[model samples]
Target: AQTVTQSQPEMSVQEAETVTLSCTYDTSESDYYLFWYKQPPSRQMILVIRQEAYKQQNATENRFSVNFQKAAKSFSLKISDSQLGDAAMYFCAYRNINNAGNMLTFGGGTRLMVKP
Candidate 1:
């Protein structure tokens, strides 16, 4: 069985600062996938980023980046230049690489509150 864990239950960042959310997983499968999804107050689920197990390089988006430590089964998300809009519930998710439809297993989540 695979499980995702977010150690931080909540985090805060200044309007223009940066924040890192920690996540770790336990999976016996060598090939798998990791993802970070954001759920805003509106309850809309959005994909933040994803990392493939076969890739060595960390995945990055505009202001979002991941520190993927395959050996440790760790995948942390770093948000740069955090804005008020970045405040949301961030969930760490994992999926089996060979599974069809790729259902994601998610962590409890980390609530990010941005201060202006």
Candidate 2:
């Protein structure tokens, strides 16, 4: 069984600064994908970034990046140049690469508060 964990229940970042959200997971499978999704007050899950377990290089998208520690089973999300729009509930998710259903296991979620 795979499980995602977000220890931080809430986080606050100043506009133009950077913030990193902590996440860890326990999984027996070696092949899987890690993802960070953001849900605003609208409640829509938006993909922020993803990292494949086999990839040595971390995945990056714009101001979003991930620190993937495969051996430690840790995947953390870093948001650079944070903006007010970045305020949302951030969730860490996992999915088995070989699974056709592609079911996602998500963490409890961290609510981000951006300050001007």
Candidate 3:
């Protein structure tokens, strides 16, 4: 079984500042994919970043980056130079490579609020 946890239910960051959202996961499988998704008020699930279990380097996309500690099973998302557009509900998800259905197991989610 695999599980993702976002200890913080809500987070707030000042505009132009940096914020890091915590995410911890437990999985028995060695090969899997970890993802950070953002859903705004419009309800569109957007992929913020992704990391492969076998990859040693952390994944980064523009202002978003992940601190992927495979040994510790921690995949925290760091948003640098936060902007108003970054405010959204963020979810940490896991997908096992062996699962044919391609279903994703998601965390409770953390709602991010940006302050001007």
TM-score of each: 0.97, 0.97, 0.98
Among residues 3 or more apart in sequence or in different chains, the pairs in candidate 2 whose N, CA or C atoms overlap within 3 Å are none
lDDT of 1: 0.95
Candidate 2, TM-score vs. the true structure?
0.97
Off by over 4 Å in 2: none
- Can you give the lDDT of residue 8 in candidate 2? 100
Question: Which residue pairs come into collision in candidate 1?
Answer: none
- Candidate 3 or 2, higher lDDT: 3
Model 1 off-target regions past 4 Å?
A: none
Which is better, 1 or 3, measured by TM-score?
Answer: 3
Clashes of 3: 0
1-116: candidate 3 lDDT, tens digit per residue: 88999999999999999999999999988989999999999999999899999999999999999999988999999999999999999999999989899999999999999999
What does candidate 1 score on TM?
Answer: 0.97
lDDT score for residue 115 of model 3: 100
